[model samples]
Target: MRPKEFVYHRARDLDHALALLAEHGEEARPISGGQSLVPMMNLRLARPDHLVDVNDLGLDEIREEAGALHVGAMVRHERYLTDPLIRRHLPALLEAVHWIGHPTIRRNGTLGGSLCHADPTAELPAMAVLHGARIVLASTAGRREVAACDFFKGAYMTDVQPGEMLVSVIFPCPQGAHSGAFEELGERLGDFAMGSFGVVLEHEGGVIRRAATVCGGAKMTPIRLPEIEAALQGQTLAGLDAAALGDRVTGLIAPAGDFQVSAEYRRALIGELAGRALQRARDIALNAQP
Candidate 1:
């Protein structure tokens, strides 16, 4: 199905995009890579009367600002996944990007687009939740920063206002040396996962100081399992009890029955995925030590 008639604006830059959004209000939609939005439009799932295209804007740069990494909203998944700086600095993100989609989709999918779309099964949003990433949203009013923990309100929902656009994503640099790993299980290779887990761990003087357990496809939004997180901190990764850990996570994420996987099945897989993800992170961390 073709979308209804709409106006299109090719924004010259950030200011142009902002102006277009402000003028059109909720009737306007921003199109970056068009990977996600195009499909939705084709199905009539989204029927925006105006499209503010930022493809002309030079917002694809990825650079280090102060102590953290700043990725422009237009940056493509392929560029991020292969960037040397991203691999060295935000290893967890690199791990997560691989699970996004196949190479073709990655080439056209922008980071900002994914976060704004907010699919519960998406890997990037789950990564943001795990690492405490910050989102910079802009509008004609001013700019506002929303932490990942508070940005996602529900499945396919976010705190972005009608006239605001997600400008960039900020990832705080690691305070101490850390290792990151991600593991996911899907019905098919490259398909959305039944359950995906991302782990980021920091070790100081050989003792685990902090760890994050970000789970996806288990709820309405990607969630950082606090119950599981509380148990893992300071506990040596090798000493993790799979059975016990499984039970704890099961209670935390009693997945509601969905068409993809049964609640019991999703609950069961979370434990397995969490255990393996933590173990991989530990191995990566241990190997990095001198």
Candidate 2:
């Protein structure tokens, strides 16, 4: 089905976008890459009366700021996958971007758009949760920053209000002792992951100094396994019993039955993915440090 009408607004800048959003309110929907939104519109899932086109707003700018990396709202997936700054600062994000759809989809998908769309099975949001990323939102009322953990409220839902637009995403730069890894199980190379996990670790004195585990595709929002992090803290990678850790992680997530996999199967794989990702993160952390 085609949309009943298409009212397009091209914003000269982010402030202009905010003005449009405020003026149109719920009738407006921000358009970045249109990779996801267009498909939904064609299926009648979304029927916004106005499209706030941000492609020309220069929201595609990407740079490193102080001790954080700021990626603008329109930064494309292909750009992200090849960005050296992102590779050095947020390797997990780079890896995650490569897993989002295929080359054609990646060329059209935007980082901010993917996060804002809030698909539970998507890669970037899950990795962002593990990295403790922050999202910058704007409206005519001004701007505010929110933690990735609190930003995603439910499936395809976020804390963003009707008149607000996501400006960018900021990720804290990783230190020398820190490293991260992402892994997922999918039926096809570019399909939504059946279960995916992101792990970030900080090592000191041959022990785990800090860790974060973000799991996706098994729940409404990315599941950050703080319990797994707490359980593994201060433990040396060499001394870890992988099997035991897997069993423990299995009990931590509450995955439900979906067409992709049974609840029980997803629950079992969560343990398996968590253990593997943690091990890889530890290895990467150790190799990078010394």
Candidate 3:
């Protein structure tokens, strides 16, 4: 299916894109990568009166500053996966992204577009939450920052208001002795996972100081499990019990059932996945110890 009639405006820069949006108001959609929005448009799920293409806006770049990474809105999935900086500092992201759709999809999909699309089941959103990334949203009025915690509101919903575009995402590099991993259970390779989880751990002297667990495809939004993270802190990896860790995951999440899987089953899967993710993350952390 083809998208309905709409005015296509190729933006020469960020200002032009914002100008188009300010003029069109809520009827306008700023498109980058066109991986997510195009599909919705073609299916008539989205019917914007104006499509502001920001491909030429010069928003593509990856730079490291201070102690974190700044990823351009136009940076594609393949770039993030292949970039040396990303591979070295954000391996968990690459691990998770490899599970998204296919290579061609990743080649064209933009990081900002994925986050703004705000799919509850998407890998990038989970990554943002996992690393406590900050999202930069811009408009003619200027730019404002939103923490990943507040950026995602619900399924396919975000804090992105009309006339605002997600300009970039700021990911803080993992500090201290730490290790992380991303794991998911999918019916087939290149297919959306029934559920996915990203785990990170920081430890010193055999004691955990910090822990994070974020899960995708198991709720209305990519969710971070504070309950689980809290439980793991101050514990030794060798003494960690998988059963107890799994219980916290299942207890904290209330995933809704669908035609393919039941909420109860998803809860069970979350429990099991949490164990596997945490165990792997712990192993990686142990290996990093000098």
Candidate 4:
């Protein structure tokens, strides 16, 4: 099915886009790469009365700011995969970006688009939460920063106000002894993960000092394992048993099952992936100290 009739407005800059959004309110939808929104429109899942084209907004650059990486909203998945800055400062992003869709999809799927799309299991949002990333939202009024973990309200929903657009994502440069890893269980290379996990580990004196762990695909939002992270604090990586962590998470999270996967099975996969991600993070924390 084709999308309903809509007025098209080509925005030339950030101010133009914000003005268009403000003028149209919830009736307006922004389009960048159109990977997610176009399909939704085709299926009649979304029928905004106005299409605010934002490709010319110049929100596609990757740069550093105040010692952190400021990734523009229009930065495509392939851009992050290829950009030396992203590869160097946010390795977890690199690890997860390659798993999103395929080359063609990555070539066009925007980072801001993905975050705003708010898919439960999408790589960027899950990894962002794992790395304690912040999302910046902009509108005609002003802008505000939100924690990645708090950005999502539920599946395909976010804190993005009606007239606001996601301008950029800010990732703190990893400091001290830290490492992160992402892993997921999927039926095939490009399929949605049955279960996914991302982890950041900080070590001191051969003991875990801080941990950020998040799971995806199995819930409406990425589930950060703070209780488990608290449990693992100060634990030596070598002494850390995967089964123990797996069992602990399995008991804490109750993910609802979809048609493709059962809740029981999803829980099992989440438990297993949790261990795998933690182990990889531990290895990096132990050896890749910078």
Off by over 4 Å in 3: none
The C-alpha RMSD in Å for every predicted model, in order, reads 1.5, 1.4, 1.3, 1.6
Give the per-residue lDDT of model 2 (tens digit) for 1-290: 87658799998888889999999999999998999888889888889999999888877878998888898888888997678898887877776776889999999898878988898889988977878889999999999999999999998899889999988999888765677788888899999788888877777777877877788866899988777789778888667565677688788778887887999999898788877877777777767665
Residues 1-290 of candidate 1 have per-residue lDDT tens digits of 88778999999988989999999999999999998888889989889999999898877878898888898999999997679878887788898888888889999999899999898889889978888899999999999999998999998899999889999989886668888888888888778788888888887766678877788877889999887777778876556564577567767886776788888898889877877777778788878878
> Which residue runs does candidate 4 get wrong by more than 4 Å?
none
lDDT of 3 by residue, 1-290 (tens): 99999999999988889899988989999888788899999999999999998889878888999989999999998887778888777778978888877889988889889998887788899999999999999989999999998999998899999989899999998877777889888778876677888988888887899988898777888888898889899999778785678777888888988776889998899888888888888888777767
- Higher lDDT: candidate 1 or 4? 4
What's the best-to-worst order under lDDT? 3, 4, 1, 2
Reference-based TM-score of each model = 0.95, 0.95, 0.96, 0.95
In model 2, the number of clashes is: 0
Off by over 4 Å in 1: 237-243
Which candidate would rank higher by TM-score, 2 or 3? 3
Q: State which candidate has the highest TM-score.
A: 3
Candidate maximizing lDDT: 3
Which parts of model 2 are misplaced by more than 4 Å? none
The positional error of residue 264 in candidate 4, measured at the CA in angstroms, is 0.1
